[model samples]
Target: MQLPIAPEGKVRFVPSIPLALQHAFAMFGSTVLVPLLLGLDPRVALMMGGIGTLIYLISTKFKVPSYLGSSFAFIAPILALKSSLGLGAALAGAVGSGIVYVILALIIQRTGSDWIHKIIPPSFVGAVIVVIGLTLAPSAISLASGGTHFSYNAFWTAMVTLGVAVVVMVWAKGRLGMVPVLVGMIGGYAFAALRGQVNWSIVAKSPWFGLPHFVHPVWNWQAMAILAPVAFVTVAEHLGHLFVAGSITERDFFKDPGLGRSLMGDGIPTILAGLVGAAPTTTYGENLGVLALTRVYSTQVIAEAAVFAILMSFIGKLGGLLQAMPSPVIGGISILLFGVIAASGFRTLVDAKVDFADRRNLVLSSVVLAVGVGNLALPIGRFPVSSLAMATGMGLILNGAFLVYDKIKPEAKDAVEAPQEAAL
Candidate 1:
């Protein structure tokens, strides 16, 4: 079957512009939302996301078609650190997280990534993904309800936004189908505007052109201790995305660009994000969605999207407009997006054919869900480990324990009988 556009396919400038814009629009809402949630500059997030994608392309030798955006995984830890120690310290934690990725990449380069699979396994990784999504559920609810106290206006607006998005996702055709998130945001924003929820003065007062406000990181050991561990979870998520993309494009991204290079591509941009006071970046599922929807795997189009994002960041008014988006619209969109994220985890398990009948798999998933959803944290000295990190650690430990047990335990009688019966 002919792909709509092959990974290396060349296209003339005019048509590629819209194709690239579609990719950018697909990623825009989620990319900016992360920084907004963490009280960082959305412009910086946009800029970093663009720069990160470019860096990722270079690091992968342009063999992989992917875009990096602000990661949702680091949100809880970063927010916790920001509240306790300040933004600089939180950003320092981001730096530490990036370092973790780099270290993992280096290890994978030498020994390969088979160890990663053995340690985490598909079941454990799927559980962690579900945990990451569910852990953030309350935040979405809080945003939808208009913060600490519930408001009728906020709830209705959120519902309208979500309703529009759902409709678009299920029924929209062609290119429109690829950008449900962006479409949903616009729908929500429009509803909020009609209700006078938007504050237009922020946009009016902002300049047309300017650079994003860049903050410098302040090194903090405690902050680092809190945020760095989450990289393990993101790495697993990254691996899953690469596998999905490879399947869609009918290419072995892991073998071609290689997993080590892919991880480094993701890591370096995250390091840059930490230094420049933006959220840590990850390979975006939104980009993958566009690729699947359009069947276009063109690297040039992805690169064009990256450039478009970079250009958008410089429009000071655009940042102001994004900032002026009301809580209800954000809440409405988050409701859908976060739920989808959680559902995707279940999909992952199904795709992996994770056997829940197996005692070990059952225990691994059960414990992960309990720890992560229950928000169980373990404090070490001054630093408190997050539920997501703790859950991931526990899952790994349990899987490792199960592996050891399997090696030492006697084989099932049915297994031995089956071989003898077959011979008879």
Candidate 2:
């Protein structure tokens, strides 16, 4: 008998149930991760993430299965907003993030990729990412040190699991490597279990399926303003993800699927999430990396993962298991992912061929990096502020300012003469 034909280069007939389950699991793992870190309901992120993915599929014509959900980058901003205001207010800011992306999509429809370069330069975007990652360093440390939902015993368990996960991730080949985060999590949980660090009562007392924490929107002026800057950074991130997916599919998505549509896709869900008290929405880069690794591009696979995530939201035990994961393990993974994200900025700079010696580039890069990492801030009227979100906002504005100024000014006479002399 002839072998079953491979459903190569096609998206139909493959989004089956089993594949769907696997996809759901993966999606659940990735999206639930964000809320877990931020002390929000992981279940909320999962359901929203699944819903967001469905929206994205519809927007992108069900071609791209890339799951959208809680963005790790949005964590610091959300946390800062919560501390400054409250949860409802912080979520309101998340809704703003979707609006920001929709606006960018409109810009893209008008100006295309060139518009991206206008607002989001290598220096600016890089600085924003750096701020996003490094700003969370404190939380990583505190959590690893048993600050939240973890004990000293749990810390060691987490550390061991994290260490093994790191090793597996760094050393493991192929499919194993693709799931380092999950591996580290499971490994950590196993150790925590052995050490009796996990409280089974939390797991046993909860129902198998129940309604998750579904938050509703309430206006908060302070939080809205505080979290507004995340729009800039996460918007840039949105463009980056679309570009990546386009590159992967070898199709100009901006042409057919339409960037505006995709943003609308991501935006609608993000808005839904914000209104429903879910975390921020985003396309997970790591999951894309996994797709690349697994050679699995089936949107059905992602759909499966999304369903699993949706189902898991109702399971207290599953949520508890995620909670049972140690802080140090997350800390370890964050360190790697954070550095990689920062390095992505460096790569962007290199690709753009921005001159370090050029005064314009130097000023832009120096100011952006310094202000970003150094936590520089600009006070607007009465609010007291200094944070990753503010730093990123300041850096982006400055970077754009430098770009404009450099473009407007002519070369100095001395520099012009010096170039002529060299030519001579």
How many Å off is the CA of 167 in candidate 1? 1.2
Residue pairs with backbone overlap in model 2 = 20-304, 23-304, 23-305, 24-304, 24-305, 24-306, 25-305
Point to the candidate with the largest TM-score.
Answer: 1
lDDT of 2 by residue, 1-424 (tens): 1222111234444445544554454445457667777777787788788878877887777776477868877777677666666677778878877777777677766766566666676656665676666666666666666775656764575577668767976899865666666777777777767776676776777667788778876786666666666777776777777777666656566666777777778877887889988887888776666565555566666766676677767887777666655566666555555656677777767766765655545666676667667766454454434566666666677766655665777564236334333756
lDDT of 1 by residue, 108-203 (tens): 999988888888777888888888889887888898897998999999999998999999999999888877878888998988898899999999
Each candidate's clash count: 0, 7
Please identify model 2 stretches exceeding 4 Å from their true place.
1-22, 25-27, 110-113, 148-155, 324-329, 351-353, 377-386, 406-424
Q: Candidate 1: where are CA atoms >4 Å away?
A: 1-3, 404-424
Error of model 2, residue 239, in angstroms: 2.2
